[model samples]
Target chain A: MGQPKQERAVQTRSALVRAAAEVFDEYGYAGAGINRILKRAGLTAGALYFHFGSKEGLAEAVMNAGQDTVEPLLESRGLQRLVDVTLVWAHRLGVDPLLRAGVELSLGHEDFADGAPFESRRELMAGYLREARDLGELREGVDPEVVARFVVGACTGIQLYSRQVDGRASLPQRVKEMWDCLLPGIAAPGTAQDFDTGVARGERLGRMGAQA
Target chain B: MGQPKQERAVQTRSALVRAAAEVFDEYGYAGAGINRILKRAGLTAGALYFHFGSKEGLAEAVMNAGQDTVEPLLESRGLQRLVDVTLVWAHRLGVDPLLRAGVELSLGHEDFADGAPFESRRELMAGYLREARDLGELREGVDPEVVARFVVGACTGIQLYSRQVDGRASLPQRVKEMWDCLLPGIAAPGTAQDFDTGVARGERLGRMGAQA
Candidate 1:
């Protein structure tokens, strides 16, 4: 209840979350064990029980924390913001254990409703797309919801292939190319050239994430 | 070998493969155990060893046989054929245990080289896109390989989401919607109206798959 004890508790919880993320990422939800997570964290069972209470609780914590890996792009808007979110997220996925573990856990465990932020992320992107359509940035008759779903779906696939093929070294480039192929379909006529899908801006954003 | 003995051997191998598919589907590649598979099949270890040699070998067998679930669309060509391939595969994904097991094993085991037919499937789809381009189907400057990769990736994501959300009942409709969003980006101007992203054709093709 004291200040120093509260800080220590925070640090312990953080360490447990990190350890759980690593184990879950490596072994998946079914294969991950509580003892292994504790060993990795170098913490006592009492500490884990005090903090997370169970493996399922720890998984929820990881998934909740995963969204924090990529900071919001308050400066960007419309389709540009959507593109930035994915590019920056791709970069972070290469380095962040908690984010990757969150993705793996949500993807591997089909029944867990609060698993990943896929639906929430989809809604967020769809909101931006709606704004884009209102501003005459989107092609006529192009549904924002459909584009949002396709973009999210494409991102999931691109990450999987990039990870399998090259440890995601080419993730930024692949994400950029995905936009290149898709922009024409979603963007208003002759406006596809107005946007930039380059990885440079996203790379800078990712650096900001690291600093934060 | 006598005819009856050879028949019995074939049946034993088939049973082992089916049982392995069930276990791999439920437990994934790492959680799947040889004992569990044997128990499911009501067979002995000798039968498994004689057929698959090891767990890795059984996994390879599952991946190889997974491709056999859908019959090739020899009558269709170009992007239409590509669409047909995905639609039929999506339908089969909901019904076939072997195909779903192969996908789970390949997706879960990142190190397995022969995991899924993703790379091969990409190459195949790219070839069709090339033909489509020559026939004046694709947009100017659109890359076949890029579209191919995106399509494969989108299909993977769609299947995962469909399975998680609706037990894959909506897979056909979702696959069709993916094409609806993508076709405008890939098709030549004015040619976009020529294609059908409907689930009806795919459902018919799925019936053919079942009959085959």
Candidate 2:
């Protein structure tokens, strides 16, 4: 009975964090009221306080949760992996209502006195770039750290613009364009030709499959 | 006397808008109260209301004002200009207490019934891409609209990341990387070689000038 109660408490905390993420994304941190968060979670002030000491604490938890979700996606992919994961995640994180809540949490920490959660993501990207270089995927004379930051920066730009605008540009198309522009610079000299050829072949195969 | 009063009123309205922009950026839209904006502008409700009918009205004015400021810069430089101007504008927009406030007002309008103000900026970029295509600056088989959106998207990403984190990657460096990646894909074939040569010559000329 006690174990079930503890599990329920954990579930409640998770629900609260998730609710808080949505509210924060929609209304921003300073604009979001604790009462609203508690109300949405269907919990009392005590439960809220127990899980997160204050609003700032809640904001941090939301960000931590988001980082937990995205960090692993970053680690598993190669350079191409980053593009694939981002395209999948962008739909969820950049477009889907539930996941889009994480965007607010990430942007809201701009006012934090300590440091923002994005720092960890940036470091993770830089580390991945270093690994990619060691694996000889990156071009000669390319600074892995610089390229990492650039890649991350480009992804950030796609998400921000996609979220703000109406039905002007599709997210997937935007991602493809960014990747196309970006690959030529960081790619080992002839690698771009190979990738382009593969993309063309893949399109042809897909077309033939669709016809059949 | 009436003309001078109108002029003074214009100046006062401008001052109030500037002050509101600062407050909105720092505290965000919902968090920023009309009283705070008035206090910052050294004015009262009557004065503010005289210029702008309501808080929403004031936000519109701020967005319109920002568009006026930003459009000319874009027009003069063309869409392909490097991130220098964009970065300068972003740093100002992010850090300036006044401009930051305006940014929040602009961003918060996502929920507004009408629409956000920066919509035209996207159109402007798309138009620039079309013009670039006619001029043979863009590569064959590339979608100019997609490329334009991609460039803008990349810029937004760099701005958001640079502002959120403290790191060795300066805004300019990140912008440069984005351009370096983008130009190769979009530039006319062999244009990358021309760019590299131009950069080399520019550096040599600078060194010779310094020695002389």
Candidate 3:
């Protein structure tokens, strides 16, 4: 018996997203071609149009899909949770084509300026840093807003460097190093020892994500 | 009397580099075209071929040109010098087209992986941090190599964020903020007060560059 139509449609949509992601990852947004994406997906142009409507639509789908990975970490809080978020996201950025493409598009494409999550990510980080401050995990005089922006920028630079240096294979390790250098500046005295800045921390989260 | 052949050739080469920088800045490396670059420069194909040989060759010229802006910072030393380097470069990256294009090309072009200055920039930063370590300007436990890599990544991230969020008009200010957040982490307790993280520190350097 054939798969149900709804189930088959869902599969097709996912397959198209994956294929588009690979193309975007390799060629970037301006260079990516719809024909190439369709060929990779082994789907008709009609299917792509029916699902994503346009190449821009498909690109937006890939960008949005990258955010779905964040759902699993919502249970955690404070500075350690912030570290977990960066670590897990770095690990996924190394392994996931959709996330990688989303980052490339978000960072480099001027037309998609509003779509980039620099503001939202900074706000999320600020929220976590606020929690850390309330819990007395942060050092005195450290502003959550300021520190949040710095962390966002630092994580971005680390990933960009790792990506260029070794295709992001070292992102988690670099992020670990970043936290090591930064934690002492932001965390309260004696509290710096409480947070784990290990690559395994991210790997464990990845495993948890898979199990769920 | 006409200009010397050498002087004319030099002018042609610099003009071509500037025009190419503008094109690459807007369209990126892959999206950039030789014809468009030639049009922007108002030069024929033969002139481009004579000067830079190929598009890739021209890109190398642009990348190398970005390093020219660093020459002025070499006379300073230790932690303050390291801060100066980032601040000055951030200021340049905000206003200079050649430097801006060089960074854009260096960060995003996969084929140019070996060409990106990730390792070299990190090494240069390490060298400065080593000077800081020798001068006892760093915190006792802070490793220069680790801190160097982190600083490079953080500066890169700060510049990238500044570029995306506001076209880098605020880069020097952001760099100062970065040093404000980071100095406590790396510098010795009494030494963080010695370094200047002001935007004026960079603007003064920019003015000196112009005068020179």
Best prediction by DockQ: 3
TM-score of 1: 0.90
User: Could you arrange the candidates by lDDT from highest to lowest?
Assistant: 3, 1, 2
Candidate 2 — what's its lDDT? 0.61
Q: Model 2: per-residue lDDT, tens digit, A1-212?
A: 35688799889988899788778877767778999888888888898888888888887777667643433423344565455445555444533434555556565445452334455556766776677677787777777677667767777667666666644235555666676766666777657544432333223332332244
CAPRI-style quality class for the chain A–B interface of candidate 3 = medium
- Candidates in order have lDDT scores of 0.81, 0.61, 0.83
What 10-residue stretch in candidate 1 chain A is worst by lDDT? A108-117
Rank list by DockQ: 3, 1, 2
Real A-B contacts recovered, model 2 = 0.63
Clashes of each: 0, 8, 0
Q: A96-212 in candidate 3: lDDT tens per residue?
A: 788888888778776666625787889988999999999888888999999888888888888788777777888888898888888877889667768998999888786666566
Chain B TM-scores, listed for every candidate in order, come to 0.89, 0.75, 0.91
lDDT of 3 by residue, B100-119 (tens): 89888788776566625878
- Candidate 1, residues A58-105, lDDT tens digits: the string is 888888888854546346789888888888888888788899998877
Native contacts kept (model 3): 0.59
Best-fitting candidate, scored by TM-score: 3
User: What is residue A153's positional error in candidate 3, in angstroms?
Assistant: 1.6
Q: Model 1: clashing residue pairs?
A: none
Error of 1 at B61 (Å): 0.8
